[model samples]
Target: MRLKLLAAIGLAATLYSCDDTTTGIGDFVADTDEITASAQTFEATTKTLKYTDLNPNGVFSRTSNAYLGKFTDPDFGTYTTDFITQINCTEDFEFPETMQDIVSTTLELSYSSFFGDSLAPMRVRVDMLNREIDDDGEDLGLYYTSYNPEDFYNKNEEALAEQDYAVRDNSWTKEEIDSIKKANGYYPPLVIDLDKARKAKGEETFSAFLKRKYNEDKKNFKDSYSFIHNVLPGFYVHNTSGEGSILYIGAIWLRMKVSYLIESSSGKVDSLVYTSIPFAATNEVYMSTRLSNSGDNLEKLAAETHNTYLKTPAGLCTEVKLPLKEMYEALGNDTLNSVSMAFTKYKNISENSANNPYKMGTPKNLLLIRKSEVNDFFEQKQNYDSKTSFLGTYSSTTNSYSFSQVNRLISQIFSDMRTKEEPAEGWDEYNTLVLIPVKTETDSQGNTIGLSHDLEVNSAKLVGGEDGEKIKMEVIYTKPKFNK
Candidate 1:
């Protein structure tokens, strides 16, 4: 699944409040029969959003007025922004570059399929933010974090050695430094798993354990975000509702403005500066194509068994992804040249590595768990496994070529068009721009008798201009919101 994240304030609430809070606001004066008559209008409004009604917990309603609701002070409550986006196409082929311009045109058309045929509506949600302030007043963003606080503490022991290294001021002997380096893996853990420890002492919830643990190791809890030099943690959204769900849930992370007070003695945050972790909502459209029955089977398998891709063909199975180069050869036209030109330029600009980020395995017993836990489990397990898809190999490296690298090469066509000039030919006349090879088993007789089979490539069209002259491309680019 392609994941894009965006943040938004409550727009629906604004629309709703405007209707109910006016000076003349009052229950509508209607006859009981008139109210009953309004049901048709209510149902009509909801039918427009038939898909959203899928959530059993949700409600659909209609109202005549829109109103604004009281908001928590931005100073105290939360403030957020939703990223507004549009599909962009910039062509970069100029004069002689027009030879490669076909690639750019092809890319522009293909790009739509990469994300979707249409745009998704925006969405907003409230998330808890964590912040720290020093005694003198300074904001420190998150410096440390852990899936489990206990895991943080375990890691913290290693960080102490690094601190010791700094305190030694290079006075320590090489032998001493080596010993510490061996003992300490890296920095200290930012989140401590107090709950686990407290449980040993008869404590219950992990939240309660944190209070107990923090009090004992208060000295270690100083403003850590300041020392947080390399790593940052960001949230991986499992799923979201409202507009984000219009095209699957847009996954997101936070970028916050924090305030803190530095302690006079320890140089750590002494008072709360106001812990606000605000997210900069951004989104990218997901692009993928389903292969008729096989594709449907793949999706169902994932949903039913909590699996991803095709581990085993469940029901109907059909075509598989054809090779790009082979297909290019089959077309026996300028398609390869166009694709190559785009691929080369895309590499120059995007510097994309041939990695499949979406490849993942079905959880051991995912279907048995509650829906809410599915996201959390995947979040935890994602770090442990290598992603691979039966549709394609895990490594971009194939028996001879890197398909993803080639795709990246193809992506360049679209990228170039976005930044460069559009070709004079335009896209209306190009018809099909991309060609891929699909192989099938063949029964043949070698020496006119012995049996043997050979594979062959075929041409496939990806993009076109008004009359199908221009070509377009598409890609799924994942950018981390904060960090992890």
Candidate 2:
């Protein structure tokens, strides 16, 4: 009896020390006693059932990739995507002193990643845009998965730079690479050498045109808006011929290297200078997809079972339908703590065969969120959280994605119940959720800024239903007050 009293006193003191602001021991002890009593009464048990449901007609976002390519994904179907970007600099461009000769002009693109096949060959054709884009990148304007690229470009000026490319960009001579790195301070995998001579149509070449701009359209180099509108329109990069690969372009630099004879403070001297314009002033990615085989899998996915799939590039998502009505009845008027679940991926033999030659496997991460919010979430690149969403990655050792935020989600449901809002039995706004595979984007500080649902590049099959042992939720709670 003496030892038990000492233990209680020690626990009370620890709690007080942790809080440091408590004014009375009576209230603290009473709250602690209530927690202890509730814990003793309510035992946690894992419930296996459908809590979130993925409905038909999931949401899709606009274009997401930089190098827009035309590829036929066996599962997700055919897609045509292109990037329209305006180039700018934090400072004004410095043109060469004298416009004497056109030495060389080049546009280089460097990327760290690519999607689809590297073994297959593809070609990217670049052209100047005829249409004008907004200078303010505050918003890239409305983009959808069904927009067309032909509507933007005029197809004028023979190809600026055409390169036969693959996933790994290693087609550069060591000397050329060293020169590029020295000029730009970075090595670009893809290089487009602008021709110095005019085209068959007698139009000015890229270098000659820039030289003309140096003398005539000097106003264009003053600011980004003038550069994009008055002098140069955005460029359109697309795949002329390719069906099995997608390239992710990170940075683009349009530079003009020139040499001129100038009479300076000394004598007449040969001078060399370069002007760099990056395509960041404003940009938009337009994506158009032609889904051909996704319906074949959806027909099989109709039946809710232990087997469900999540395909990407906005293809298909797994739906979960939790029994919110039953949960409310079982734990009426309780202080909820948390809720968690584990989702597992199963084996699919056709994952790498001729049928799925792409060898597309499960996505690195999955998102859990309200069904209706799918549109705004992807359009804005929102994150997974306890209130409205959750994200989990695949664990190879366990072959599963675990989500443990039931209490936080359920508590929001309970909080909504206070408003007397018309409920769907137990939930106020949402009772169904779908698992979406997304391309997450982060800020410079390493915080997630948004998510892109525009690329159709990922797919996965998940094990669910009553047969899977891991497909269950464990919700913790403290019982309510009793009227004696």
Candidate number with greatest TM-score: 2
What is the C-alpha lDDT profile of model 1 across 27-110, one tens digit per residue? 234332221100000000000011111222111111111111111111112111111111211122112211111111000010
TM-score of 2: 0.73
Q: Judged by lDDT, which candidate is best?
A: 2
Model 1, which residues run further than 4 Å from truth? 1-207, 219-296, 299-484
Evaluate all candidate structures by whole-model CA lDDT and list the values in order: 0.20, 0.56
Q: What local lDDT score does residue 255 receive in model 1, on the 0 to 100 scale?
A: 20
| TM-score for each predicted model, relative to the true structure | 0.17, 0.73
- After TM-score superposition, the amount by which residue 85's alpha carbon in candidate 2 deviates from its true location, in angstroms, is 2.1
